[model samples]
Target: MSTTAIGINAAIAVGAYFMTVRMIPRLRDMFIKANLAGRDLCKKDKPQIPESYGVLIGCVFLISMFLFIPIPFAFDEAAATDALTGGKPATFPHDKFVELIAALLSICCMIFLGFADDVLDLRWRHKLLLPTIATLPLLMVYYVNYNSTTVMMPNFARGVFGTSVNIGVLYYIFMGKLAVFCTNAINILAGINGLEVGQSLIIAASVTVFNFIELALGHQVESHQFSLHFMLPFLATSLALWKFNRYPSQVFVGDTYCYFAGMTFAVVGILGHFSKTLLLFFLPQILNFLYSTPQLFHFVPCPRHRLPKYDAKTDLLHISTTEFRLNELGKLGRLMVTLLRSMRLISWQELEDGRVITNNFTLINFVLFIFGPVHERVITQMLMGFQIICTLLALFIRYPLANYFYATET
Candidate 1:
C-alpha cells in the first residue's frame, strides 16, 4: 500500500475514534436540547443513540480504511505532476495525502461552525464566510493547475449567452461562490430527517456511476485510471451516517456532518472534472434554492417567534382544499384563518415557512431530473410543452382550487 493511503486510513481511524469517544455524547445532549425547543426533527420518540449509528459508523470506517490502506499497492510515489497529468496514472502518493488533509481541515471547520450555530445561533453571513475561508486552500491548489485556454462557453454563443468567457480570476471567484452556494444548499435541507443524507447518497451514487463509465471507456490519463477511490470512501461514510439519519432518527447528522459532507462531494466533483455533472445530479436541490430566493423577502416582515400570517385571498397554500373539508367556503376559510392566527414569523420562523417554497422547488427539481439528460434542443421543446400543460392546469384547475379555499367568503 502507498504511504499516503495508509496515512489517510490512519487519519480516518484516529478521527472517527476521537469523535466517537469525545463528541457523540455531547452531540446527543445537544440534540436533546434542540428537541425540547422543537428545533430538532429527529427527536420524536426516538432513542438517544440509534442502533444504526454504531452499525453505519463501523462499516464506513472499516471500509474506508481497507480501501485507502494500500495506496502504495496502487501507484508509484516518485512520479511528477506532469507524469500524472500527462495521462500516466501513478501510485497513491503524498499529493493525494495532501488532498485528504484539505478535506479533513474542511470537515473540522464545518464541525466548529455547526457547534457555534447550535449553541450561539450564528448568523447567515458568518456561515457563508466560514465555508469560503475553508475552501481557500483548495482553491489555491486549483489555481496552480487551472487551464486558461479552456473555453467556458462557445464563441458563437458569446453575443447571446455570453459563452466566450475565459477561465480567469473571475472564474475562480465564481467557482468559490458556487462551492459556498452548494454548501448552504445542503444546509438548508438539513432541517428534515434523512433528507440531506438521502439526497447526498443519490448524488454520490450518480457520480460514482459516471466515474466508472469514464474508467470503462479507457479514458486513462497516465497509469492511473479514473477510479471510484475517493467517492467510495465518502459513499461508505454517508451510508454509515444514514443508518442513524433515517426518518424518526436517534442521532442527527448535524450541520457539522451535513456541511462537510456536501463540501466533500463538491470538492471531489471539482477534482474529478465533473462539476457540471455534479450540478446536474443535485439539480433538484439547486432549483429549490433558486425558488426560495424570492420568499426570503416575503417572510422577512414576519416575527421570528410567531408563524407568519397567510393571506387567504392571494397567498395560496399548496395543500388541496379537499384535504381539509367544510362544504361552505366561509367555514373552510375560518379554519385557515384560525391556523394562521396561531402562527408567527420570525427569522427562524421564515425557515419553516420556507418549506413550502422548498417543496415546490423539489417538484420543479423532479421535473428537471426526469428531463435533464436529453439534448438541449429537446429539453427546451419539452419545457415549452410542459409550460403549456401547466398553464392549462392552473387556468382550469389550480386557480379554481385556490379560489375555493382562499377567496373571501361572503
Candidate 2:
C-alpha cells in the first residue's frame, strides 16, 4: 500500500512540475498585464518582473493535493486501514480524511492571506499575526484528532521535569507560535534571486528525506506518509518556480510564495507529529531571525528593505547598512551593538562624526560581509550550501546522538 501510494504521489508530483513550467510563461504575461510586477533591484536596469507568481505555484499544488484525496482509499480499504493504523484492528480511517481536510483548509487560508498581502501590501505587523488565524483550523484538528501534548525530556533534564512533560494548553500555544514562526521565517530571510524558493527547496527536501527514513524504519509510518502527501507536490511546484526565480530571474515570487511555502512547512510538521525534526531543517532561518532581532524590534533603524546592496560598477552585492548616531541608542542597545561588532557578527565604520555606519542584520548581508562582495547568485548558493550542511548535522543529531539524550523505543 505504501509503495502504491508513493508511486501515485510521484506521478502527481511530476505532473505538477511539468504543468507549472508550462503555465508560468503564460501566467507571466497575465500578471504583468494586471500590473502585478516588481523591479529587480539587483539588476542594473531593474527589470520589471512578474510578481506574486507564488500564487500560481500554490494553486497548482492545492489542485494536485485535492486530486490525490482518493488515492489512499482507492486500494483495498482494509489494507489502507491497517497501514494507517499500523496494523491495528481493521477499520475505516476517518481520522486520516479529517486530517487531510484540515491541512487543505489551513493551506488554503494561508494562500488567500498571501494573495491579499500581495494585492493590498499590508503592514508588516499585520502579516506577522495573520498566520495565527490561518493556523486555528490546524490546531483544532490536532486537539480533536490526536492530542498528544507531552514532550520527551532530555536525559539531563528528565530529573528536573520528569521523563515526559505534558505541557497541556501551552503545547497548543507553542504550535500556534510555530506556525507564526514558520510563516514569517522564509519571508524574513528572503532577498536576491531564488533565495526564498531555494531555501524552501532545501528545507522541503530535508523534510522529505527525514520522512523517507522514518517510513523505511517503520517508525510512525502513517505520520510520515501524511507529510509526504503535501510535501511532494509542494517540492515539485517550488522547483518549477525556482527555475525562473533563480539568478537572471524572469519573474519575482513575491511575499505570496514565502507565506505559502512557510505555511506548507508548518502544516506538514504539525500534522506529521515530527515538529521538532522539522524545525531542525530550518536552522538557517532560525539563525537569520535571531540575527535580525535588533532591526526587527526597532533597536536599530531598519530600512524598508534590508536587501544586499548591488554594486553596479563591480556587478557584486555588498553588505547593506544603516546609519545612526551612537548617542541615539540606549545604553543597553549600544552595548548590544558594540558586542555584536566585537564578535564580528556585524561590521561597522565609525564615521568622522558621532554617527555609526553598521551593516544591516540579515543573513544575506552577513554572507557578503564574511565572503567579501560577490555576485548575487554566489551568495544564494553559499546560503543554500549552508542549509544543506545544517540538514546533515540535524539528521546526525536526530538519529545518532538522540539516544544519548533521551530514552527511546526503536
Top lDDT prediction, candidate number: 2
lDDT of 2 at 362: 94
Cα-based lDDT for every prediction:
0.48, 0.89
Using Cα atoms with residue i matched to residue i, what is each candidate's TM-score against the true structure? 0.57, 0.95
The CA-based lDDT of model 1 is what? 0.48
> Deviation in angstroms for 59 in model 2?
0.2
Question: For candidate 1, lDDT tens digit of each residue in 1-410?
Answer: 23354346446644554445454445555545545223331232323542223223433444454555445344444554537678666555555556545545554565566556655667778878987887776676665544442444433455675644455676567657767877777766434456566666666666666555555555432111222555556665666566555654546565555565666666765555555445656665665565444233332111222111222444311211111112322543434433432442101112333321111112222333344333222332343344344334433432245344222110
Root mean square deviation (Cα) for candidate 2: 2.7
Model 2: lDDT of residue 181: 94
Off by over 4 Å in 1: 1-74, 77-97, 147-149, 152-164, 220-227, 297-410
